[model samples]
Target: MEKCRASSRIVIIGAGVSGIAAATRLLQNNFHNVQILEAENRIGGRINTVYFGDNVIDLGAQWCHGKQQNCVYDMVKDMGILHETGDYYSPIKRVRSNKEVIPHELATKIHDIAVKSMPSGPHPVVGSFGTHLAQAYWRRIESELPELDRTVASESLNTFAKHESSIIGADNLFEVSVREHIEYHECDGDKLLHWGTKGYRRFLRLLMHVSEDSPEELGLLEGRVQLAKKVTKIELACPRKVILRCEDGDYFEADHVICTVSLGVLQEQHEKLFTPPLPAAKVNAIRGLTLGTVNKLYLEYGKQPLPDGWVGFFCLWLEQDLTELRKTEHSWVEGITGVHMITCQPRMLMAWVNGPHGRHMENLSDEKVLEGLQWLFRKFLTFEIPPPQRFVRSKWFSNPNFRGSWSHRPTKADERKTGPWDLESPVLGEDGHLGLLFAGEASSRNYFSTVHGALEAGYREADRLIGHYTSCSAKA
Candidate 1:
């Protein structure tokens, strides 16, 4: 039996933020024998950015949700990376379903109110977020508020719901937790730092910096990362040693393995991937969590698409019945939970789709997707619109490497009442030796479903091993 060495053979599964963070931390702590096995050829798991001509299009993560307290923000900001500040309500250009052009001042005011006045406390009678929202709107309508106030309030609430639901990645609002509606890690000054051409992938390379040779020195990390290496199985009968098998017939042995694969993948392949099966708790944790889909539709055009210096388009169907519209099959635009025109990039427009609609939209041909967008434009805009020159889209749900975009508040019956701790807990063998470990945004209790959350989890898992092994070595 090969003895476990803290400095040798630490395998990290997945090349996402969590995996990369883990590998870097291990190296920092003098554990050089680390290997990163990424399924896809690319590095960043969900923080992917690509270019269309001169414009930068982020098909995955686009913003640092909270800047002041966010680690991602701290790193990027310190690096002097340039980005634009943004939010849900863009005043420069927008189109609502009611055909009303909302003034920038009014839009900002309404957005502020809606965010500050989010309904507090759990809804005992209303379990679903959709029902809760409906009830709240009806209650407001019954109030003595002025007609203008009511209109503004209605639009604000609807906009908030749609935007937040997109962030949650749940198609049906009812599926979202009424109690857990507010994200726990939401920091003060909820600033949205939009990454332009710099792209979020900059952070992956930033995090990989370990050697003192130069800022760009990632020779160790670059060599350790094996892209296109899909881990098929993990044989862990030996307490001090484990073996990993890849689809390409390559094999590797490691003393410890950190499984940073997304919760969605774990739920799908846990039974088949682990040898002798995981314990009931670990299996239950995987089952209990929910993985939601979020897709983006990127459309590019030649020259200035809209009015001179105008940003992007925003289609807020204020009067449309969202609940009924979601059930419709023909309205492909309806599948899009929200649409935003990139203010910084005038030639591109992006639409966000969540829930099952995300999957449906991704499966459609490029022509079909464009047709749906056109239908939306004709319905919402009063003026004639031109077709886009080129189009691309995201299929995070359909992609086996990432079954879903992010994690969401799981249904009560799906998860243990103790919360996401079990989901993040290290999967240990029956003999009480640590055999497998877990880390990801889903595993993070405070920062779940955020890029920083995933990074923090990776750092935490690495620190865990650092403390455990280093302390043991000292005693020995």
Candidate 2:
């Protein structure tokens, strides 16, 4: 048996924030024998950005999340990627019956009341987030509230339900929504938002800073991250070494291995992937939670700074029976309810779409996708909407590696209910020796789905491996 050396090599799967963090921490801690194995030819996982002329668009993670206690923010600052104030939640652009854009101020006021005035304390009746948020709107909106049966579906409740689904990536609207948690937890919606690259990539690079999103960028960053390394199997049976098999007929043996692949990959391809097999509990947790996608439609309107600055999401509202949208697929989509447009400088606007509705919209062909937009465009304001001079889209869900967007609030049954083991991914054998170990965002808790979450988890796993070895050496 090959004795694990203090410099025993470590292999990290995935080049996202988590994997990069783990490798960097190990190297910084004097562990030089480490290499990152990324299936995609890029790093940073979901924190991907695209360069179009002067416009810097983010196809993956666009937000920096909480600023108050956000660790990634500090890292960004450390990396000198300064951030300015943002207007993400505000200017709540909404499309109305007239096909004209509704000022965000109106919804902001209503949302404020609803959020601040939510009911408190435990309840005998346990309802889904949709039910809770709908009720919250009723209490806060008060007179502004729409008709409601209370006994059944209410207008305000249904709208809230749809809004929640659109925000969260839930399979259905009325089922359960991640938006409730965001609204319930986040006191202030205003936080750091998109600013070209805004040091977002720089910050991540400083942390994990391994590979770039695209093949070209990888060359730009130098070949620190190994690309096109499709991980076929992970063997952790021999406690001191984890062997990683690549599809390209290559192999890597590491003292510890971190599996930072998304839950989507785990859930979708777990049966054939694991060598020693993942815990039954962990497997169940992954599948129970749903993975979603967010596709963007960037429209460059011929340098025309029209009135109201491109009307900022100026599009028509769909008239589907909100209830039907809540269903997975009720025959077909009824009609456009609303359109969100953001008119910005350099002539560019993005249409933010997520959840089931976003999925339906993104799956369509480029021509069809544009047609859907034109349907809303024509219904709202008539203009010579040209076949976009530039088009941008994301294949996050379709990609086998990514499967979909980042993690969401796992289902009640899916949520991890216990200690930190779920957070401490292992790649070694059961004999207390090291074969391999894995950790990353999907392996993290509390901070999962965020860059910091991925960072902390990566560090934790590295520390675990290093600490265990340190103790064993001390005894010797």
**Regions of candidate 1 where Cα sits further than 4 Å from its true position:** 1-6, 82-113, 121-128, 144-159, 210-219, 308-313, 316-329, 413-415
Write candidate 1's Cα lDDT for 16-126 as tens digits.
999988988888778879989999998889988887745567788877777767778777676556465745455544457755666777666555554544545533422
Question: How well does each candidate superpose onto the true structure, as a TM-score?
Answer: 0.88, 0.82
lDDT of 2 by residue, 369-476 (tens): 666665555544635555566667776777888887765553353244422244354534777665555565655555555666678788887787678667767777
Q: What does candidate 2 score on TM? A: 0.82
Best by lDDT: 1
lDDT for residue 310 in candidate 1, whole number 0-100: 45
User: Ten-residue segment with the worst summed lDDT in candidate 2?
Assistant: 329-338
- lDDT, candidate 2, residue 192? 50
Candidate 1 lDDT trough over 10 residues, lowest sum? 410-419
Q: Report, for every candidate in turn, its global Cα lDDT versus the true structure.
A: 0.73, 0.59
